[model samples]
Target: MRANEGRESAIRAYTRYETLTGHVWRCACRARMLESEQRTGLVVYVDVSNRLQPPLPSGYFGNAAIGVTATSCAGDVVSKPVGYAASIVRRAIDMVTDEYVWSYIEHLKNQEDLSKFQDVVACGNPNIAVASWMRLPMYGIDFGWGKEVFAGPGSMSIDGDSVILSSSTGDGSLIVAICLEAIHMDSFKKHFYGGII
Candidate 1:
């Protein structure tokens, strides 16, 4: 049992390593796209949940997710190492404290024209949005029968977006689903899987 526990711990650490590396790789891909597509600043939004150190009840089902934006110039993101982009992502996420959450709430409440907030982020202009569902019990979800054999997001157009889904094997691995324009998909795939930079 102790050995199994140790193995699981190591696998979890490796999963985290992969996730960070994947994120940086995605950032680099976006930067390359910006240069190819003649776009400007890169605005990356990462979904951050406040449930880690919840200020509310543990079982509260209300939405506790916030989108944290990390902005950088195209040249900076492309020229820097993966660790640099990872650091920017880490800092953006770490800034979401309880106080920051409350402030965001207040800011939303004070909005005069909430319709402006409803506008979806444009896919152009070097934007990337990433949402991770890795920790969710996706495979365990069952309507009445036993655990599901497989589960994942339905097919959708994800141009300029990415989703991290839990692997179906119950192992500490993640399935990153990315969507890109047909023109840029080849380059993105090269950087993503090949670690070209």
Candidate 2:
């Protein structure tokens, strides 16, 4: 696993050698299932009850494996593969993806010969106003609990691993709510409650 900015990161890429025939759906599902199994298995195998951050990208691939030699249920323990299966899988995926990416880059660089250009606009950002608040009234409907005490807009966007939520009152009073994935949700909840977790 590679550490980025003092945080561990694992990037996993899986390639199935079987679908050269171009059956897209099966191939895609297989890859997705493989990734899901890896993620779920490793999370429990490591007993990382309190750990967070999606297992870093480098260690992600170490999770691929065939057969259910073991089982993990909630907090229950079960047999696990020998050695760092998750880590090993992760490395293999990264190596393969890196090779592919580099090969493609090299091929493009040789053909397009655009390496001389310093500033290239990949795509111009189209100005789009995201109105998530328009969906706010829908939330109360989901819970089947009738309308909320107040219907207002929540201003927030996900920034990397963090989520910034803007809370506004009917009177236009505003507050910021910072959130992170599962583990950090509690902290954000506390902040959201503002003294009532």
lDDT of 1 by residue, 26-81 (tens): 55456355564333322334333543445566566755687767666665566655
Query: How much lDDT does candidate 2 score?
Result: 0.26
Best by TM-score: 1
Clashes of 2: 12
What's the residue-level lDDT of 136 in candidate 1? Answer: 72
lDDT string for model 2 (54-139, tens) is 33354453332111112122111112221223233233333333344446447666875666544432111110011112113223
Candidate 1 displacement at residue 39 in angstroms: 7.3
CA lDDT, every model vs. true structure: 0.58, 0.26
Q: Candidate 2 versus the native: TM-score? A: 0.17
